[model samples]
Target: MKKYISLFLLSSILVITSCDERFEELNTDPNRPGGSVFDPNLLLPTATFQHGDLITGYSGPILFQSMWIQALASTSTGGANYYSNADKYVASPSTPNYIEGNWNVGFSLSSRLNQMQILAQQRGLNNLNAVGQIMKVSALSVVADTYGDIPYSEALQAQQGISQPKYDSQADVYNKMLSDLEAALNSLSASGDQLRNDVMYRGDITKWRKFGYSLMLKLGLRLTKVNASGAQSWVQKAVAGGVFTSADDDALVPSDEANGYSNSSANALNVPDDIYEVRWSKLMIDYLKNTNDPRLRIVAEVPPAGLAANRNGLVVGNNDPAVQIGLPNGFDLRGGSFDISNHPNFPGATGSGGDVAIIGAYSRPTAIYRRRNAPVFLLTYAEVQLLLADAAVRGFVPGSAADFYRQGVLGAFTSMAKFGGETVSASAATAYINANPLNVSSANASLKMINEQIWATTSLFANFLEAWNNWKRTGFPELTPVNFPGNFSSGQIPRRQPYPAGESSTNGESLRAAVTRMGGDNWITRTWWDGGN
Candidate 1:
């Protein structure tokens, strides 16, 4: 009996060994390549979606940039003030989590894009490689714009044994971005096969090319203050290369409520906590109302109900542009003091009751602003036209600045109709453009007008970070700095955000060196292109 059991055990062991030898082969799906092989098509969608998520996500634009630009204001006071730190410019001991999250998202996407580029190159897929390069440029630009000096040259070089990469100057990063974009534009051909999972342009190589050139135009405009000659050269190159001529070529991320791929603004601001706490800033509301801008009704909503009703239940407001009132920045719910009599038409609580009056009287964003599946515009034809207007004003491109400016205004209204629903018709857009035509007489005046228009056009779905950067570069719209107590920058708007604190422990030497080179790792420290206050 012992001999028979030993033979059975030996047979079982042999059978197990045989199965182990063929295990990987049997489990591997022939349709899907496992392990080393990567499909660029599959990777493209991930990069694109992440890029959209990062730009519109709370971490990147909605929370910081939008507030910085004064397009949105926080109503929370005391302990419950969620974004009070950002609004008041109170410097924490370390970088905010959202800023760090934005940095990580950009670099992570870049790393994946690097892998996609290598695989695409090996496969002789030029268009795929170009797309990867374009994405890499876009991702790294966000990093540069956010933190000034960052890991650029040696970034994502883990395969080459580079764990701790040194920081590169913002100028170098911008130059490299331009070069990579130019190369991408050159590599893309009409004959090349279309991308399988392109979310921005479907499979249209022409639109892709236009998007690249438009991005180049934007980057070129960023250097206007720091490197005027360089800015002109690149702007001219972008104009000659061709850019988005119409709304059809606009780079937008389509939203789907079913799959949880919704608009980032709605995701961040539509929640009950944020909806009641966040309202339109006095600056944005005043500007639109004063200009008689048709977009006001689409962007803002009136106060919900009477003071008693508001306290009982959170009843929403009507979408009347005339009744909208923006909340002033630098005031918390308890600290806010407004003249209630000024807004007799306001449906919310009247009289002077501090938090109740301020919170219940001021206009919050409209439902369109909080729509679940509203598409987020990445880069639009309006932006391209505005950039061209700037270039033309600077004598870098042909055509009158007024012409491009008018086109920009018209394009912005037309594109924004998507969010405004059926109410914002083409005739309404044309009428608005006609009413507010570019009437500046001189170049400097034209620049100021153009940039101010750019500011308003970029307020809603367009990239607010770019608007903040534009404000930093041009000093247009003339925003007054909030002088809250315990503010970080001596009551001035911050020039750049601090680097993440984790870098001090993980990449200590490089981070210290960057801080030293950048003067200090504080918010007041300006980037290479800021040209100081």
Candidate 2:
């Protein structure tokens, strides 16, 4: 729960900053290492060097999670964690609000990645290189996915002659990512350095390689729609070349919590939308309760002071004057939304609430955040296993579906153990297998079991990105879309994040080009990878 909340907060800060003038002020970095933004001398780069405007003795979880408000409910979180002043999920044409602001965060990180890539090559720091490139590609991939056909040709060239880059097609961006990943993996392998200062791996080269391969597979799998063959080819290549074998080797960035968690905003705001009532998306909560999954205690926390808990499972999105409960996504209670007058169930005392986590917050000794040294994982072997299980059923790849399924649960349990929590008893895993074993043919039955487990286990492992991805891909467990009486369109799960409002003013031509490429940027228009009816 800590890491999940931390990620949300991290993203909120990044997005809210969104290249604003005050952004530099937030970063009070004390270190001053010179020459080019991406100097090769600094092999193990810190946030201060890359971002310059940061504080020292303060760890940088800011670069940890890339925030993308993919849905309308996005504002609830932004309002709480980012702006710290917003009372409702309201945005006007003038400010464009937090959801739109996140687009800038993703791009800013990508720009840093580009800068790093150029400098590494120029200085022959090939040994210390690929990691930067890998991160850049990963960040840029999200940007392209969120806002199709972004300013690819001209982006990240402040040092170069171009400040405004032309938008590149999503297709081209994918092509570049694939090419860059391939090159990065090979480069890291060929150039051998001690790699002594890795926060993610504790200087483990093998783990980094696995991380790259896993990311490679994730990127490939996203194209499973129109490019099934291509997706398959990449998946196969990644598997054959080797990917993560266990969750411990997962890729993550550690938060610098030396200051009793005061230095990082993301670590501080770990609750749902920062307002607390994470109203168990009927889809999310029901699945665990139904399966008797024990991972539930780790995510939910009571609100700080006011709002009561929606205990009776007050069906979310239910906003009828006649109906008892449930409000639409982005429905402001201050407004006349009848369904959202106040939380009725488990609301916590003042400031006691928390957000959902990417991985388990209830690990053995203490939660990951309490460890004071836990890292933010980018990907893990457990996710790969779940994917493999999915593929096993689909016959897209060769493996025992049941075996892969079982391993995923066990591997996930093992990974969760490292986060200062109780080890998942083997009996529990066995019992789950007996009760909800993989049902090879009945896709929904097998998938529901797999995905629910994945969600439970990967709670602290992946952040909002994982949740959004699953919701977008399978629509399993079926989260109820927030029902707003005043919604601009039919109440449906939000599909893609809106382009940042700044794009309209700063990079209008490229932004419009992206919208044109992606069905005019409507909320309903699907991403290239999403293809469920």
Instruction: Give candidate 2 misplaced runs (Cα > 4 Å).
Output: 1-95, 259-275, 301-337, 340-374, 418-422, 455-462, 531-533
Quickly count the clashes in candidate 1: 0
Error of 2 at 273 (Å): 8.8
RMSD of each: 9.8, 9.1
Per-residue lDDT for 419-530 in model 2, tens only? 5545668787677667866776687778776766655554444344554565566655455444444332245544555676667787787777777777766545776667
The TM-score obtained by model 1 is 0.87
My TM-score estimates for the predictions, one after another, are: 0.87, 0.73
Query: How do the residues 318-426 of candidate 1 rate in per-residue lDDT, one tens digit apiece?
Result: 6677877787666654433523334344344554554354455677776676776677778899988998998988888889888899889888878887774635677
What is the lDDT for 521 in model 2? Answer: 68
How much is the lDDT of residue 526 in candidate 2? 76
TM-score, candidate 2, is: 0.73
Per lDDT, the best of the predicted structures is: 1
